[model samples]
Target: MDYVSALLPPVVMAAFFIALVVTIVKSQGGANKAKEDAAVDAALSRAESARQSQP
Candidate 1:
């Protein structure tokens, strides 16, 4: 019982960590991916325009 009590916290934390990772991975796909890619491309174009406008 002593060993089980000592080890339970790490096991619980590992489970929660795995769940959070899975959620993040799942969220990165589907409709959100297209929007995210577009936003990134827009940002890069804006940055390039700003650079060209400077030096």
Candidate 2:
């Protein structure tokens, strides 16, 4: 019983961590891929333009 109690927290934490990783993995490069890419491109362009204007 003592060992089971000690191991239970780790087991539960591992399960939740696995679920989080799966969720993140599954969310990538789907319907939102284009939108996410466009957002990053826009941000990069903005930063590049700003840097060019600075000097």
Candidate 3:
């Protein structure tokens, strides 16, 4: 029916969005978590040091 057709796309998109979120959540905080965090910290520190040196 018209209502079923209208609702189907939204339902399908929501299901895929939920799956994507679940995959992202599961991929986080494993063996690479510390490595990723260190990389971020290093980048931030480098930026801060550069900003301090600018003036």
TM-scores, all candidates, are: 0.67, 0.83, 0.82
Task: Score residue 52 of candidate 1 by CA lDDT.
Answer: 98
The top-ranked prediction according to TM-score is 2
**CA-only RMSD, every prediction:** 1.9, 1.2, 1.2
What tens-digit string does per-residue lDDT give for candidate 2 at 1-55? 9999999999999999999999999989999899999999999999999999996
Clashes of 3: 0
Query: Which should have the higher TM-score, number 1 or number 3?
Result: 3
Measured with C-alpha atoms, the lDDT of residue 4 in candidate 3 is: 100
lDDT of each: 0.97, 0.98, 0.97
Per-residue CA lDDT of model 1 for 1-55, tens digit only, reads: 9999999999999999999999999999799999999999999999999999997
User: Which one wins by TM-score: 1 or 2?
Assistant: 2
Question: Number of clashes in every candidate structure?
Answer: 0, 0, 0
- Cα lDDT tens digits, model 3, 1-55, are 9999999999999999999999999889998899999999999999999999997
Scored by lDDT, model 1 comes in at 0.97
